[model samples]
Target: LAKTTQPISMDSYEGQEVNITCSHNNIATNDYITWYQQFPSQGPRFIIQGYKTKVTNEVASLFIPADRKSSTLSLPRVSLSDTAVYYCLVGDHGGDTGRRALTFGSGTRLQVQP
Candidate 1:
């Protein structure tokens, strides 16, 4: 398991693009980078995941470098509703082992202003 570091907080206005970067210095070969967003008193929602290169979905885009040390979560046209705690997790989720589970950190609080 690798420890991840993210911003403590971030601020953005409505309809602006926001990019949150997470650093994982000890990432493994079987590891995958996953991003999640959580609201107050709620479970984290899966946003995106990538093994390497880039991955894009309707919600967000994940960019990973060839070194596999860090990743960035890009949210386009964010609104106030997108404001929440974003978590960057790295693990191998292939089977039903304990590695499938995600460890939640303090997360980066995203504050979307009007």
Candidate 2:
């Protein structure tokens, strides 16, 4: 597992675009970057994942550089409900062979105001 670093906090207004970046300089070849969003008192929800290049979904887009040292989660037209703590995790998806460990950082708190 590679340790990740993210902004402690971010501010955005409704209908604005918010980009949160995570740094994982020690990432391994088998490692993948996964982003999650979580509200207060709730578990993290999967946003997107990528090994290299860019990946986009209905909710957000994940951009990873060729070196895989960093990734950015882009949320377009965010609303008040989109406010939450975003987490970036890096690990090898060691398939169903056995259990794997997941380490979480402090997470980036996104505040979406009106």
- Local distance difference test scores for all models: 0.93, 0.94
Q: How many residue pairs clash in each candidate?
A: 0, 0
TM-score of each: 0.93, 0.95
TM-score of 2: 0.95
Candidate 1 residue-wise lDDT, 20-114, digit = tens:
99999999888989999999999898889899999999999999999999999999999999999999999886666654667777899999999
Look at candidate 2 and tell me the lDDT of residue 64. Answer: 96
**lDDT score of residue 84 within candidate 2:** 98
Q: Which residue pairs of candidate 1 clash? A: none
Compute the lDDT of residue 75 as modeled in candidate 1: 97
In angstroms, give how far residue 113 of model 1 lies from its true place: 0.3
